[model samples]
Target: MTPHILVIDDDAAQRRSLKTAIEALGHAVHVADSDQAGLEVFRRHRNEIEAVLVDLSAPERAGNGFLRALGDLHASVPVIVQTSEGATHHAVEAMRAGAFDFLVKPCSIERIAAAIDSALKFTRSGSQGKPVRRARTGTVGFGDIVAASAAMGRAVELGRRAAQSVIPVMLEGEAGVGKEMMARAIHATSERSARPFVTVNCAVIPHSLIEGVLFGQDSPAGSGEVPGKFSEAEGGTLFIEEVSELPAHVQTRLLSVVQGGEIEPAAGKRPRKVNVRLILATNKDLIEEVKASRFREDLYYRLNVFPITIAALRRRKEDIPHLARAFVERFSSEQRLAKPLVIDASALALLTGYDWPGNTRQLENAVFRAVVLADGPVLGERDFPQVMAHMASVRASGDTAGARSAVEVGHAAAAAVQETIVHAPNPAPTVESPAPTRAAASGDLSANVIISTDEAGNVRKLAEIEEELIRFALKFYRGQMSQVARKLGIGRSTLYRKLKDYGIDPDDPQKHAA
Candidate 1:
């Protein structure tokens, strides 16, 4: 069952964006615009809701009040706080008030998903919940496939339904999307679990030999019989990979086997009954192949009976964090690490931002490489130099196709709403100075900007100048909190508070009437 999460945030845009991102993580979300609405939703669906996400920057500090209300109601669901204020006091206060986890704003979706996963795991462990049963390693089952994204979840659900029958399942997806893995899972969960699961890649075999490799052949030397994959998987499954590459003649033979449940052991030899289940996988679009006169229409119809299309890795980036973590755990054990190495948030963010062209296979190999070279207990951003380099190259080329610089949710809005608190060095007492040169060379243009003067040529209010500087700093640093805070000579909490006080919005800088 998918976990249900309750999100309480007064900002409608934030609520919508959060819901979009969270639902992609394979969870059901219930949202509220206020603490009272949140409480009503939680109370009505307390048994189903597994976690709660609350914004700590709500008006009147409603997040803090909600925390106290949850305590009063004796709610046990883990509450994760996501706030714009990056102050130590804010985090400490939330933790002391019983937040299960704290996340700073502009947080990566991967980090939020990881935190929710941990909270759920803790809850399950506390409740003594047992994991879903699955086949041992090497025998892939639906349970072993990480379907943390809705697209993959739908595909997995289809595969599960197909596994209950002996129907021919056609898996269509890009190479490395794990079509073969899905085939294995289907076979493992089917009634043919104990039977042999033979595999043959039509694309890899020689065109002349693919037929013989699939349907068995009589020994030309008359020494004995040459058993093909179908014979080997009698009363079991035969997973034909790259099935679109099968020869025209082999397609006819495969069609016969599919329609009549029989296979020819050899040319001119009597047809033999084989109880093997057929699961064909192909990365090609069979419909296009058929239109191109490359594949048999009848064979396409036969194999397309139960089609399941696995989504590419990029289309389902929400699953990257979980998949990467699973690979890290597996490789850590394989490499025999002294301690299980964990992936840091920065590293996960880096990975989740990239569009993996090779899909899961690529991510798996990347994690394996990182695990082998890592010397520390945690894998950091430095561990993935190749990915970093690729990301840099992509950014340099202005190629949005390769990777997104950041997650889309509230990224621009967050950037627009920052404040600057950097205190400048005290000016020399009434110095007679020359005209100021461009401050761009020193990378502090905000310092040299001409202050606004009134109609009488008098200097403007200090508060007004401060607000302009804050806006300049935010634009200068590109919304990087650390850089903005350091340049402003103030802490992040102070910057956030100032931004609130000045009513600074990325869309609308000044809120007060002129």
Candidate 2:
């Protein structure tokens, strides 16, 4: 279908050019000479217009002000700002002010058409809409997480409420849960959405240099230095992932940043004040870490002011079908499949029944694998070999001795089993007990037996499962653990233990090898 486009520019030539190009694409076009004219056109044909292409350099009117005004009009029309040469900052400003996309001036019709296509796609998909004046621009919203389960619904509600406040938000979940996604959603729904949403994976960076990377370091004697995540996320959010991994000294500095909104650079430099909303995520139990004296109690309280725990995927199994469909749709679009991919009931059931150790990430990977491996347009149970295997293991584990079925009751059951096996109960159950029998029924028992000889043997099976789940959750949550855990329904401590146990490092193996 031909999309209706409105071109608004002070320059008659620019307006005419854009109008002509838009029309040439078989789209209906309208022209407005100024911001006033654009608003009038928008009002007159508000229903007809699909998008507005505005010139950022329109005379006498600040592009930001114009965009801001349009935002105030409650116009759902996607706005694409046209920028003059060397106006990169202006484009970003426009984006901050609710412009859906930007086009550099002196560009060919091809580029304009491409930008329009992208903007229209974004609009039609309901991805970006009317400017959320008070909402943080890039902060993730409920739409981003795509959860339908009651637990997930509550978590999302909490996220929205947390976003409305300025308090530091602490997200606790398993490694594969969509923590970062939730954090981003909170940012998107917050007042700081228009500003940068900087992320610092605490576990990824070296412990020796976290402070400098997070707070920024001063330039050496003659060289210039740059600001770090704190300054970069000024007026927006500083998302710290795996926050429990932060060293005690670094935690002190981070606490100061969160409490006082300032950080002193290295080499005795003066402290620089910033206005970044703090969003911390950890798969580890900070409370436990605090007890162990590894995490600062003060810092914990500061971040815990607005604590949000994401439900694990297994707990929110009801949302699996929807999530699976979303993933299939996403991958199918990305891959440009000949036909839209469909997931049959059995395949979806297979997905819903399995314990997603990796949470949504694993689910997405399973879907991606199914999409890629499928010979037909529809994805069937056979397509997800890993998912099927996991399902079999879970079923077998549950049916073997029926000792409150660890695989069926979710992570709580697994934790109970782990405690039973590791702590050595008074009656030290024999192999005939439901625990060992169930473990044996599940293929994981064999894997556990193999790793039992290792120093970390007891944690091995859980670690491997956690690693797989985290990796899987990464795919769906796009590596955001809070969301992964929320979808998975496990505590962050459980998630981290698995990561450490499995040794599934996120860093590039090639770089390490080199």
Candidate 3:
């Protein structure tokens, strides 16, 4: 069904432009000249209308009253406010009064479209009333979450369930999988939405200062300079990222918060009561850490009350187009680029082909880099050379058996493009070799070949095989990363990552070996 949108703007020309633009997006537009008229129209067609776009400056009492009234009336229908330069403060007040988001005057078509898209999503969310989509923020929300894969859908559902409770939520994922963003969304939808939301990076904060940074002291100045995150996030949320990086003592203190629901400052003699909804994120498996004694078992159990595992970017290839577009729009707006960058099909295909080792964060950064470097309005395959290289390698490797593992794919791509004409024994016991041995063959492609295999030649892990292949390629390429990477069927970046992972130094490994 076509989404219905109500636009309340006094300017006839502006209303026509908005209606045209929104209708072009396949949404039915209902235009009203004033807030009262808009409300009457909305009341008559409440169920049909999905979203409201209002000019905050048009209404009486500076728009907050109008927004409050709309919220009181519609309750669930999202209301987007538009403000001019001097009305930015009023816009903030409107948002606090339950406006979904505000658009500044002279806002670009892209920005307005993004805002409406978010609003429509929010409106749909309210209609669905799914518990998982509780995080309703002006920015990222469960509704705005770019998840096309089943894995991510499940994660979002779990996150929603976790948001309904005040218990600690533990998000486990790779480093770049947007754990912090998800935490924010969870907090935004939770009952503590009105309270302060604080974040603490356990990995970055100084070891000695962490305790005082978390648990506020009783006395002034000497005891604690500022209110700790617990006190700062009172009646709100405290999101602790890289929780596994916390020192043992700090972990113990956090465990106390989980168990006792109060904090005992190092300098304070008494335990102080603080109300905070705890949300912890980690890139490691806490259960494995607990088993290895690296993480406290009790603390892990407490935080793991509602565990959410985020799927890495590579596993959800279908979401690449959506995520890339979002990033392009977001970064384009941020950079103040005059024209929005458009990713061509070839560029998108390349983006979807490679395994993003750093996950969503890496893709976002890559898109940002592309947007920054891109000269043309249309971002072509050349706009992202790294993705192209990896895509080239991955496709080149598909000629043989399906080698989906990054390492194996890299090796297969290398084998496909390598100039050495090296040969290996028949991959299967009964299968004939593609090329004849030097003894039986003329000096053709078959004659100049050496069998590339593991030293043991038994069934070894693909990683071990890839390491040997990479070593051989580096030797053959003589430290030329481009040649080596191309031969290996991987991006130079991926090749570099593999080198670091395998500790392969093309130039000076012997010196560091000792």
Q: Highest TM-score, which number?
A: 1
Predict model 1's lDDT versus the native. Answer: 0.71
- 425-492: candidate 3 lDDT, tens digit per residue: 21111101122122234455433344455479766677876776777666444344555777778975
- Local accuracy of candidate 1 as per-residue lDDT tens digits, 1-514: 9899998888887888889888988999999998899999998998999899888754246266777788898887878876553231243355446666655454446546766887787566633422223334579889789865445656777888999999889998888999989999999999999999999998889999998888877789998789899899999999999999988888999889888988866556788898989898888768768867999999898888998877677655546767877788777767766566777656876776677779899999999999999988789879999998997898799875343423332222233222111111321111011111223426664465746897899989988888777877665454544456778899654775677678764222222212
Residue runs of model 3 more than 4 Å from their true location after superposition: 1-138, 217-225, 393-514
Q: Which candidate achieves the best lDDT against the true structure?
A: 1
Q: Rank the models by lDDT, top first.
A: 1, 3, 2
Order the numbered candidates by TM-score, best leading: 1, 2, 3
- By TM-score, the better pick of 1 and 2 is 1
Summarize candidate 2's per-residue lDDT along 28-104 as a digit string, tens digits.
99898877888888889888888888886533444777676777888767787665422333554455455665543
- In the predicted model 3, the residue pairs found to clash are 132-160, 134-189, 135-189, 414-487, 414-488
As for model 3, its CA RMSD to the true structure in angstroms is 20.6
Mark the regions of model 1 whose C-alpha exceeds 4 Å error after superposition: 1-7, 11-118, 122-137, 405-514
RMSD of each: 18.9, 23.0, 20.6
Q: Is candidate 1 or candidate 3 better by TM-score?
A: 1
